[model samples]
Every structure is written in C-alpha cells, then in structure tokens.
Target: MRTNSPETKKTARELRNDPVLSKEYTKNKIQFQNYYFKLGYQWSKPDLNSIVCRFAVLIQVIRIKREELTESFIEYDTRFLGGNFQIPDSKELLLLIFLNAPLYQVFTTLRKCSKRKEKYYKDRVGQRFEIQIGYE
Candidate 1:
C-alpha cells in the first residue's frame, strides 16, 4: 500500500514536465504521476473499480481482490487458467510470478487487437462507409 502526498505529486509533476524526461516518458508511455503514487508509501488503497472501467474500454485487463493475491498466486492462476503448471525450482521466482501475470495477458491482448482488421463496405454507390444494420 503506497501513500501519496500533495508535495510528492507536485515534485512528480515537475519531473514529468522536464523536457528530457518528458520526451522519454511520452515515448515510453509511462505515466510518471501514476507511478509516483504507486511507489509512495502513504498512498491509499487502489481503486479496483477504476481498473475495471479502464478494462471496459477494451483494455482486456482486470484486477483481482488483494486478498486473492500471494507470491505464488501467479503460478496458481496460470495453472488454473491454462490447466497446467510451470516447473520452477525457486520459491522466490514462484512468488514473483503473480506480479507479472497481468503483463502477459495485456501484451497478448494488445497484439491481438492490433492484428484485427476493421471491416467496411460500400453502402449506396461506390462510397465506403461502416454500416450497422440487421444481421438477418
């Protein structure tokens, strides 16, 4: 649980607005303000509903209950979702797996979305436009 303060947010704003860092951050699409709050020790509990709302915009991501998370939770979730287990000898590695689980899904979903083709048709006469008509 990270804590955020107004002073910290102001500092982050300055850093994010810096020319060099701002370019790099924009190129990487890194939200410095968000990361600042996440790393801040005084930040409040994350809003799970916000995650869901973002997902509703075709983000294809979701946050599980914090109670449902554990070090080995990622491995367990992978097995549950894929019906298999990964053989890892290190317990530490197993614990770290959960933290990155969302990453795998997020990348995969983004790739899939990118590869999809948008369908279009000619409505009347040689005019290309999208249509929303009866499926019958």
Candidate 2:
C-alpha cells in the first residue's frame, strides 16, 4: 500500500505561530500591524484578530501557489532588493525562476501571480525568510 506525505504547512495559522515566521514578521512590527490596521484597534488589540488573520492567509496562499508553480521553494534575499522598488515578499523567487527555469516555466511563473486582481502589493518590507530550493 502507498500513502501520501503530510503537508509542510496545513494552514496559515500554523505558519503564523512558527518562530521563524514570527521573527520575519516582527522585523517591521509596525508594518505588519498596519497590514491589518483598524481605525480603533491599532496594534496590540484583540479587535484586529480577523484582519490580521486574513492577511496571514493571503500570505500563506501566495507562498504556496508560487512554490507549487515553481516546483521549488523560494525565499526573501538578505541583501536589499536590487531594484529601487521593494515589495513585502522580496522578488527573489521570481528572479530565480526567470534566470533558471525553462521559458515555459518562466512565463507560467510570471503569469500566475498576477492572474488575480485585488492582490497587488506595492511596497517595501524588511522581513527575512528562506525556503528550500531544488529544481525538479
């Protein structure tokens, strides 16, 4: 008989609780807080739970989809993003895909992220992260 392997991350909540995730998000505490900023709640308030949770889920989904598409893990670069622009999740993975993947994979990798609307993020983040890397 055969069995499937377990998921590395079942949900965003699990990732959020991870010490590594905590360390990365905490780099710019204020920015993370602002991601869920509520008029009255602000940071350190229980009222912000759902809002923060939503972003957490989004983060988890994006990371997962990107990984699945790339067929490899990705991570934020320790060095500053080479371009003048900065996004919350560094474009390190995108660069790796563009530079290394086959043309078809590269096109798919680039297109997958923007296939949806209402998820465009244009900003800088200092969070640090590293995901496993291997080419299939």
Candidates' lDDT values, in order? Answer: 0.27, 0.27
Between which residue pairs do clashes occur in model 1?
Answer: 2-43, 3-41, 3-42, 3-43, 4-42, 4-43, 71-95
TM-score of every model? 0.19, 0.16
Candidate 1, 32-125: lDDT as tens digits: 1121111111225444333211110122223233344454544333332224333333322211101112233221111111111111111111
Clashing pairs in 2: none
Deviation in Å, model 1, residue 28 alpha carbon: 3.8
Question: Candidate 2: where is the Cα deviation over 4 Å?
Answer: 1-111, 115-124
Per-residue alpha-carbon lDDT of candidate 2 for residues 55-92, written as tens digits (9 for 90 to 100): 11112122233334322221222211231212235232
Q: Show where candidate 1 strays beyond 4 Å.
A: 1-3, 26-136
Error of 1 at 117 (Å): 9.1
For residue 38, what is the lDDT in candidate 1?
18
